[model samples]
Target: MLLAMDRVTSYYGKTAILKDFSFGIEEGKCLCVLGRNGVGKTTLMRTIMGLTDRSIGDITIKGTEIGSSPTHVRAKLGIGYVPQGRGILSEFTVRENILLGTFARHDGRPDIPEVCLQMFPYLKANLDRRAGLLSGGQKQQLAIARALAVDPKILLLDEPTEGIQPNIVHEIGETLMTLNRKLGITLLLTEQHIRVARRLGDAFLMVDNGRVVASGPMAQLTDDVIHHYLTI
Candidate 1:
């Protein structure tokens, strides 16, 4: 497995958000986490990145335990996160924002990877522009680029298409598809759009009330399962 959580229980200030949750994604595959609001989808991403207040259980990347490792260590172990809301630094220029990801690179190289620029021509053209000034869609592109700078084995994206225009959403979806399918990067994303999940994911994990309610190959995500767990 590229990433696996074995009975992980994650907490935020003593309140457990993910209760004994467990899932795994194989190398070079896309896994979509499906759930309604407040169902611990985002928490699952955070837990794997070690961003929650605390967590207990086994989280392994390539058979190595990272449950107790710090966030930076986890990043160095090849986990790239494009957080919810596109967590780019408002004060930093586009170039600076991408450079931040390189901090976790084992190579310690300060230069942004050429792949990051190649993937987003707009960002490459406006490297000196302040990140805060970009449109929501553009910021999202930057977020993915920054994550790519880490040269990760697995990418964790929390709501990668949230609050964007429909056209931009499609474009971002295509970009992600290329990353996963063409470049062989593993993807683990939380998505509200069932269409996007169905399109991108090879497998599905349905989350509800901080638990895994259903999971299997994407083919197994029948309409009955969707109606039962995903309907609002």
Candidate 2:
């Protein structure tokens, strides 16, 4: 497994968010976490990135115990997170935002700086443009690019299709597909929209009330199951 979250548990203040959550992701596979609003899908990803307070669990990346590692340290160990909102530098140019991703790598994965351009070509053209000046789709592209700049083995994406136009959503889908197919990148995506998840994921994990309710290949997720566990 490229990434493994074993018996992961998390909390927000006094409220528990995740309860014994566990999952594994391999390189070149897309694992989609599906649930309705506020069901801890994002919390699970945040915990893996070490952004949230983990109640208990072990996060292993390529056999390295990274559950307790800091967010920046996890990034250096090949974990990239594209947050719910596109997290690009509003004032800085696109190039600068991407360059920041390469700063932490001790091993210096060559794919860090250049591969993002291959994934989202628009970023290459808009290198000189300020990230804030770009459209929502463009900003999202830049955000994904920045995360890729560090050449992460596992990419955790939170709602790539949210609040975007259909054309841009299609582009995001294609971009994600290309990354996993050609580059053998592992993807752990949290998506609310069924259409996006259907197209982008190879495996499916259904999380509800902070626990793994059901999971299997995307093909096995029937309409009835989705209506019960996923639909709002």
How do all models score by TM-score? 0.99, 0.94
- What does candidate 1 score on TM? 0.99
The 10-residue segment of model 1 with minimum total lDDT is 223-232
The residue-by-residue lDDT of candidate 1 on 74-148, one tens digit each, is 999999999999999999999999999999998899999999999999999999999999999999999999999
- Where in model 2 is the C-alpha error above 4 Å? 108-112
RMSD of 1: 0.7
What overall lDDT goes with each candidate model? 0.96, 0.85
After best superposition, candidate 2 residue 159: deviation in angstroms? 0.4
Best by lDDT: 1
